[model samples]
Target: MTSPSTATLHPIGRSTPGTEWWRTAVIYQIYPRSFADSNGDGLGDLPGITAHLDDLAALGVDALWLSPFYPSPQKDAGYDVADYCDVDPLFGTLADFDVLQAEAHARGIRVIVDLVPNHSSDRHAWFQRALAAEPGSAERARYLFRDGKGDGGQLPPNNWESVFGGPAWTRTTNADGTLGQWYLHLFDTSQPDFDWANPEVQEEFRRILRFWLDRGVDGFRVDVAHGLVKTDGLPDHLPAVDGDSMGGDSDDVPYWGQDGVHEIYRDWNRVLAEYAGDRALCAEAWLPTVDRTALWVRPDEMHQAFNFPYLQTEWDAAHLREVISESLRAFPAVGAPATWVLSNHDVVRHTSRLALTAENPQGHGIGPDSPGQPIPEVGLARARAATAVMLSLPGSAYLFQGEELGLPEVIDLPGDARQDPTWFRTDGERYGRDGCRVPIPWQADAPAYGFSPSGATWLPQPAEWATLARDVQEADEDSTLWLYRTLLATRRAYALGSGDLEWLEGFGTDVLALRNGPVTVIANTGDAPVALPAALESATLLIASTPFAGTAVPADTTVWLLAG
Candidate 1:
């Protein structure tokens, strides 16, 4: 392994005329409330993000995808959107968002805003009006409001479980103080799911898309993309496994990946295609297979869907190779580029998750409070290696905020400090996602790690965060931040995005070697260093997760070589 060299960096990828920038673009995911707080109000806002645009541009990302900043009571953070068109006062005004977009675009970075079409906050005016209206009123028809199963409407409409926990249906009280209709909420009770069967619901989202597109957004990252349409009759479905788990393979999982959802995207796709600048839609759909996931990105559907299987695969060479091959083969059939991601606001940070035992691979809700979890140091090594491999692969890559600095899950937040509904809903059996949502550390010595001047953060930062602060990492060439910067820069230099991936042979089961364009990416997933195969031994090393001294690729490290 060798240290990254000081090479003048190029942009994420070179754009030719009529080329779709998103096919190989590197998009950074910004969880608004935790990214940067410019108002000193203890929350990250649009202006805060605007203040940091230069830093993001320097990071070499091609676009910025902001998680919802919409008006909300925040029962599920910003996912419970109260107003689709307005910004939450806590985050800033709509005017602030425009400035953020302008600033990001000015720096040659595109902006993709989150669109939560599957549901809306119970506090949304439409949902409120539904509560005031009669059971069959037009206002109540916008969402999934149904009669309960039992007499007197005491029981829930069905046995469907919420993704957060508990029953998916919640009984609402009418203005007269009597128990009213039960509405469906796949997530938190505050997030009422929409009835996609309604024409008004479908048209409302079209208007919303035009509203944001008219405002100059480059694209949208669709939340719960597969969940727009449900099975007819809202049938009762109880899987043999934990029904609440995401990305199930069973077709019996009633609410996910229904055939009708494709038609909705096809309609949405037409609206996006009407706009200039290739305004794309990236689906957050968690389907079962690479082939199935590719359907969301078919010719008339979304442009890209998040590759959760790649993100969820255990740290193994053969498993990774198979996923890469499948994803590459499947997406090209639809003429869409695959999207890669590691950490996100909803899951446990990869660095922390990879440190855990392989049997429980996903880091979704794990935190410091979880007993017997492995230390962060062990995971940081593999995380660095894994990121190098992911960035080198053919596709667009989504980077979670602070992942460049090797931030781990802040698992130690006090019980009362937690806000994720999963904790309360599951009766503390699950710790929830508050740990990974901790504000990113920027300045090592600054209060609240420089996330806000007021030193107020919605989630507490661990003391070890000071060592992993961006400022500290920026000054160190061997830092994880440097690795990411170098990797992105190198990936661009080689123009390896959306290319054929040919797997190289003669490597151990723990070693993965592949060629894309003129560059070869090799990874050592085992505990011991491995010698490079005959073809790569003489190749020039471009960048590596660790310092290279000889022909050996280090344990848990990935290296890129210039093809011979």
Candidate 2:
């Protein structure tokens, strides 16, 4: 295939007919509460997102992904959704969502909403009814409510632990003040896992899918897409492995990446196909392998799954080259385009995470107080280079909010302001993800950095954000924000997305070089500059993560060359 014409690189497939926009689109993730606030409530709402639509349009993204804005007790942010069909009052009414959708479509941008099917808030009406009903009653069947073990059922049902921390099961008191059965919550006690084994549970999600699709939502970002279904029986778990905090490479876990989850997506895919407009589903599954993750997008299931193995891999060229090559190889077998990402709300910002040395790689938790953290400048430099590398690859890409502005995780959040359940459950031992979820900066001088007119932010913003604020960065040509805008425009001009990647060799052990259509992207991760190889010596330079001298590629930099 030739490089995409400079015209809008349509996600609605240049190679095939119909709306497969998701196949190669660059989707921006908006963490609603932190994106912008229009009501002076110090929290972002649907209308706030609507107000900022033009800014996103100017950023040149093809789609906007809103993290859950559903009504909830705020137990696990919006992930513990209490209502799936309506907008949370904290955000706005369904009518407000309609305006946001209409405005976005008017700008030629698609909309995808977050769908948390793996679990529901403990306060959900269904969960409430389950609590009031008897153990074997149909009301309790929607969730994984099981009898406790040991005398008088005092102990939990099994040895499973919460991904946030502590025991996964939460024992409840009966309506009559008696010790009742325990329910499993993979994350927090207030977020109970649904029993996908129940046909009613599966049917309810189908109805939910139809409700949103009917509202013109382009698709759903399936939360914990690998976790809807558990093993046949609620079984005991083996001791957690070194990297098994949330997800890992193990295949036999009782609740993760089960074969049953694919069936659930296959069913959902049928629902998606019924709607026109190239409706699609993107799974947020953290399966152990790229091949295993590819199963969710096997033409009959989700159209795309987050390429987290790429996200989790260390910042080294050989490792990166292997991941890129294997990912490109694995997805085509399933006829799906690989999705690339750098960071999200749930983890430390890649800027900070990449700063860590190999000896102190991060796990589930990170904060300013963490021992031996790397300097901020070093992390940001690597992050900028990594972003360039990601955009040059084949398939779709998802950008976490504020990444374009080079936002680093807010590590200095005070202990009093910590809200992530991981922090509370672990009893202050772990700082949790609140740092990454801090409100983003939009204006260098405006109140709350222009995130809110009231100058109040839900999560505290660090004082250093003044320089990285969007307005400040947008004015500086050498800024990270400018680099992202230029990168996106260059990618579209070169038609790099959704193309075949041919690995090019002889650039040295620390340099990664690949040909995506007419574009050749070279990334140097070595400690010193390297002379450009003969193959790329005469290629036209399109863009680079950092300025270069003559034919030498600077250390920790990525450059895009237009090949003849």
Candidate 3:
């Protein structure tokens, strides 16, 4: 139970020639708007990210995934992309992105850009031209423009609802100024879904992929990976997805996880194979189960898919054990490693989520203004324990930007300051993702936590973050930031990323004990302290989330032990 400030570090052989760097890599997700801001202008930009490359490189992650920085109207942040091949002026020019990519590569870190192919901004040239042409014209053929039902086409084509809220279809004006056709926008009105059945649409994305690949990007995180190809005939049905997803996990859903999406990835895989450096593609597919999700990451498809099931599991030992076991069993069957993630830009942060109570019904999203009481201190402990257990596993782990500093969801963001489409579309019924995406605290005393030089931020940060700033944690050995650095160093020392997981029985479901090579991770999620198994009483202690001096592990804590 003794916690150490640091672990013995070793040189990793991850960069050797002929090696697939992503197989066992640790990747960090950066929400571009929240990470940093170079200009005093209220938003973060690409130059801001380039200025912080040293910070990420020292964090020990093998790769960094940049959320959409493409040109857009910021309708749904940057997900509503207008141009796919170039960086948006709000972020930076193409030269800034190239400089960032080069800087990252120089530090032995790979870069993964977000690819939002499911839809494009309404301002996109294709979509604008579609509005200017007739319903059946070639200009309108690339998107999901369909004729409405009922007399005079008053009703929508189907009963499908937008994942944000309201109907998924929005009527477009024809050349004569009459409502001509209905176009589908699964997320937001500003984002119109594309007709994947069209060969022209598919070819355009292929060229876009090569465009970024030619610029030295290592891979892509395919946004809405399962929603590209809709069901034929635009069949009508309800969908069962979580608060943060448009891609439904159910098979009956018309616009998600369709079979035709495979052909797109198969073609993409071939295109990736054409490039050197083993360029990879990871999916953001939200399938029903990891077993079903495995279908999207077959050898000829994506290299990795986010384990959403594991992310949503309740903070119970048995539930976590079950989902982790499912993820472990499912991904390897396809020669792809299971990717573990706790939080992302689209969902509530794990630190706040793990503290959900019956009163705090924000297992998905949180709002401090709403009637609920969330325990922040208790949640931080569990989040740290979960990170320890996840990194100790035998697959890649993705870390959200500010989790290391134990940042909580900004549940009290004012209604007027919120910008997520879900918030506006739902009329504030759901708080949306503004809470988890506040600008990350960097300097303890600087204005706007040093996010922007002018003390201006797109989303306001909490005053309490002063204590959790990076500079504060950098000085304290017991801080979460130090724990992350040491754990990452330890993970590389053992090469635990690409290995097998063997569960240790006899401990029951209240405690999860698994052996990965020289490390044995034992996590106790119960209300009472638990003694380590008798055989491991003599095992060497590597590190722990909470500082303790006893052989029995504290409740809601995880310890990594080195096997003899």
**TM-score of every candidate relative to the true structure:** 0.95, 0.95, 0.95
TM-score of 2: 0.95
Alpha-carbon local distance difference test for all models: 0.86, 0.85, 0.85
Residue-by-residue lDDT tens digits, candidate 1, 268-350: 99998777777889999887788888999998899989998888887899999898889988998898898999899988888
Clashes of each: 7, 1, 0
Q: Write the per-residue lDDT of candidate 3 for residues 532-557, one digit (tens) a residue.
A: 87788888889899885648988889
Q: Any residue pairs clashing in model 3, and if so which?
A: none
Query: lDDT value for candidate 2?
Result: 0.85
Model 2 poorest ten-residue lDDT run: 1-10
